[model samples]
Target chain A: MSEQKVDTRLWSSKARNLSPYVPGEQPQHANLCKLNTNENPFPPSPKVGEAIANVLEQQAYDLRLYPAPESDDLRASLAELYNLDINEVFVGNGSDEVLALVFASFFLKERPVLAPDISYSFYPVYAQTFGVELVQIALEDDFSIDPDAYRQPCSGIIIANPNAPTGLLLSLADIRKLASEHSNSVIVIDEAYIDFACIDETNSSTQVSAVSLINEFDNILVTQTFSKSRSLAGLRVGMAFGNASLIEALTRMKNSFNSYPLDKLAQAGATASVLDNDYFEQTRQQVIDLRKSLTTQLTTLGYQVLPSHANFVFARPKDGNASAVAAKLREQGIIVRHFDKPRIQEYLRITVGTQAQHERLIDALTAMQTYSEDSETISNMG
Target chain B: MSEQKVDTRLWSSKARNLSPYVPGEQPQHANLCKLNTNENPFPPSPKVGEAIANVLEQQAYDLRLYPAPESDDLRASLAELYNLDINEVFVGNGSDEVLALVFASFFLKERPVLAPDISYSFYPVYAQTFGVELVQIALEDDFSIDPDAYRQPCSGIIIANPNAPTGLLLSLADIRKLASEHSNSVIVIDEAYIDFACIDETNSSTQVSAVSLINEFDNILVTQTFSKSRSLAGLRVGMAFGNASLIEALTRMKNSFNSYPLDKLAQAGATASVLDNDYFEQTRQQVIDLRKSLTTQLTTLGYQVLPSHANFVFARPKDGNASAVAAKLREQGIIVRHFDKPRIQEYLRITVGTQAQHERLIDALTAMQTYSEDSETISNMG
Candidate 1:
């Protein structure tokens, strides 16, 4: 279909100038190795399907009723899992929605909010949508967030741990420092990929979650999602853990937007998935293991891979033609993400897939490398 | 849990002053006559259940993948059903979300947007959330919208057809006139309850949908939801029909906010429900018949019931104590909506439920009348 030509005269100034975030392609074909979006290459816990089926079987008639606007059951389940009071949690259709609400609730101030330049792209979209000025702090050469950069006076700060496309994890100490230094501003730690990060054995808990800081810092808001770790991307379930007041602000924004954002099936399925910790641990571990292997394999191919803590890895090819390599991979029925943005145009963000899919991707890259060598030899002979 | 005491210091100025929209109660009890929300009494088409189950059984593993960002499948289905191009339809998590996006897309202008003062209270909340200047025009003494009020120069106009809580249908001629006069501004027609309005048999189609006006008016937008006629309140699917330019603006806003607002199962189930027109017609007709009988019964009990064209009947008790009447109904396990807003404070918006539930409600009202008479006699004797 042709692109729609919107009438700028009829459009709001915000809509006319909106540069919407472009999501990764969700190709409908089944034969391709889909590693573009950072979705866990595994099915969710068996309980999720059962829970959804049960809702259909028993409460199908009750679909006529509105779901609990508060999503109390899911929030309670999340609070129980996180060892926090139910008041500390707020759930939404997805983390995107949660983040959008956070922007509206906490970031619309006279001072500009701070974020990493190359973090989750949706941050700027939300900033623009709410008319909040966002000052993006540049990531360091090694793609790590500098806590000192966020020390400046700002309205708020939003940082994605194990930041997307770069996949580098920020230390909890750094997170605490940022939160402490920016005490006046709401510090939102977007932990969307925190589940895939290596467990911090030195910490009291095995998980490297920023939720622990909520008690000490009332300004800290940790947002998470069931999409990556729990393998429920198709089901839009996201949550945030913060102080009661922060959660209350988000709740107000959510209520103002949509009272029942999470439908019955989503609530039921997400709650069941959260309850199955064993299944969650197993799948997350599998993705972590795959990420390691993929990183090693890419390193062997002379790709300078970043230290990845998420389900995806960011790597620049030694020859520095990421867009070309991505196109080549697509021709071979494999998909990987390559952003044509500044400071990262040469990097490809490849999601860690299952063993078989990884092997297929490796074979495709090997074939391309060998063909490149052959072409070079022929050019030398000529 | 106690009410959360939000720290206003930590909240944005918007969130600090935000008065969130309060949805009707969703009580957990199984036996209550839930006539509070205007939800359809019938279950969704059997096909919706089958479709959801099929998605679970077949693509359950694919839950690991993100849903199509644009919900192209559902949009295509809706376009087919409505005889519009796919680009003309925009879907969201719910009509609330759709409306929120619409406000963000088309109403955030320097000039204030106009809305009915006593209509859906959510409009004001959205205006506050988006920081849009909203001028609430007064409805007529009989609670019908005055189209002339919307003719004034404004940024936009958003009116609920067969207006909520009032259940009075504004004629398409009036809607067309509003759109025509406000040609320079975006005119949004919220048709959340339009499906429950009486079918115009004299028209080419039986349903009274303003979607027909979309082709003629580039500035007009019609929004609808599956919650009312399709009996899928718990599914959370809503759509907007407009010119491609308006639809494109909404798409930009939705993408900027959340890529996959409608989850996989929601897309599947809503599509199936839309395709099942026979079941929709049967259930909608049932609601219309039940509403007629309920209006007659309430009128007999000294209530002035408005001539309703929607799923619920708005009526006022002769004594004019709606809060007291609503409390009395709650005591009898019969819940109905009562707004404390100005101009509509005396009315109770009773949803049209099943015949059995209606009988229970009527019986409770009769018992209340009898008790009131007995109490009066006792007071007189004393």
Candidate 2:
């Protein structure tokens, strides 16, 4: 680190001693193969654009008025889609903001909150921000969250479904067990990738969502985002579904913090996207198919790829040097995510891009393997 | 409020005990005169719509990508406009969100943050949300903040320029004195209504903003919003300007909380609004003119109106029944704000609307006064 001139005295102890989360770099390189962030490969539904234009046109660009503090239309759409009451749905700027409010609203206590150590890193950052003690439980050898490990007195538990950096999913039965065991504390099921984790190919009969247990389990709050499945990352809309009481708690915190976190355009666009189920189904299925193709190619390259139910795959390279592999791909104008943290340093969490993008990445890796084989054969000749 | 089956055990101590803020009601009455929430009466500049459309058209509605987590474009535009470095500008979902982050980042010390009593009510709610102690210094009899009362040990101080509800503005000298006195603590000057607090009619010189003290004092942080003067309340864009080090602290906390609080539409719209200075000036001057006419008519009706430097005037009705007056106005499809809190319950905060809006209000109050005069005359004759 460079020698700094910032006076630490001006910052609070919280700000001075805190470590902030660094999101993936958004390189503006033209024609850059950007796959570091797990954004959907497809754009949002066409209805989203129409709805936004309608808000401006019908209201005559009525951006002067504040949006509905209750986020009435968007929440109603979410409620209908989820088969829950409107009061059971809570909206925010993004799932990050919603999760931050979750941490502030339900996770502050004398006891610590439990999270998988290899899960979303934002968990610990929010813990530090809200002065909540977070105890990170180690995942099992397969990188799956152990439901039994969370059987204790904690203030809350937050687990990202199809956990990031590992892309390993836990069964709904395991989630049910966790919720039943810790009936008092909040069991947050962050389903940012639930759409990609469809149970059946039909995507009609079964959906892998903890939202199904919201009514049966009052403490289970499911946080989802429009960023991944709905492909509205730039719009900044996220929501939570749970019992009305729990949603009320999040709503109270939101009102106290910032009444209108969801902007007017965000509300309109997200509502339209939610109502367009056909486009959503087609796009998410495309991501699932892309993930399947990428996973097969990585395995063929002699990499140990985790069984992913998300729009990304976590794979250990053949040489077990994930950082070097990520760097090599970057040299080829390909950007994949690699975490330098313990236990996951050897893994690269590559988002499933379009077929052509992934083909380029696989082609480069295949060329690298061929070079290794040729070098060995030449050594034998020598 | 009602017989409920909510499981209280699911919530934290904070959510259970904290009192959330309630914003002004957004009534949907067709003929409603909404002078309650202090929203700008005019729409944003046409360039705002054009810029937003360009994002969808040029980027192909690339709402699939995440917004620049750094909020690069918007912050750069603000920096260029304010004559500050980009590092000195921080953006958030709204000024309310920015204020929440400020409270979370700078006010978490032993000494309580201080504010004038009867200032922005969001101050205390943020304090409660972040677990900070807030010491409110009572305003003097003339409804002005006394700087001498703030010279004491404190963690931070936040004063809204042209203080809300009262619409009274403090001189830049007073703000400079506060900053110099509290050099060790953060001095937050919330300039939400600064554009309406113009020094001269030209609005070209001698603007009443504490942004001037940002370079002089490291502790001075000035916050402004596009919602008020820029006519983009529904877009949810706000920013803060200060010394680089102080801004870095806020940036750290924001990264910890929510990386991309501002959406792409907000960034594009607000950037265009900042560049369109002529439209901003014309709309804000119209508000000032409307405020003048409203104040004159209110005074003629025997109401005690405070000299306002904002888009709203704080006035006590002649009958001294603010709730009754507000109720009567509601019956006429007109709405104004009334606070039932201590020391200000008798006053109404009325936003400046169109010339016709104030004329209608004047006519209603005139009829009420005439009825009272007739009643008194008839009683005297009897």
Judged by DockQ, which candidate is best? 1
Task: List the candidates' TM-scores in order.
Answer: 0.96, 0.97
Query: CAPRI verdict on model 2?
Result: medium
DockQ, every prediction: 0.78, 0.74
Candidate 2 local lDDT, B1-382, one digit each (tens): 1427655678889998878898999987687888999999889999998898778677645799999898888889888988989999999988999999899889999999999988999999999988899999999999999999998899999999989989999998999899888889999999899889866745534668888878889999999999988989999988999988888888889999999998888888899999998898788888888888888889988999998988899999877888888888888888999999988999999998888888888887776666668886576578
Candidate 2, position A30, lDDT: 84
> lDDT per model, in order?
0.89, 0.88
Docking class of 1: medium
Across the candidates, what are chain A's individual TM-scores?
Answer: 0.95, 0.96
Best by lDDT: 1
lDDT of 1 by residue, A45-149 (tens): 999999999999998998888888888889999999989999999999889999999999999999999999998989999999888999999999888888987
Displacement of the residue A325 alpha carbon in candidate 2, Å: 1.0
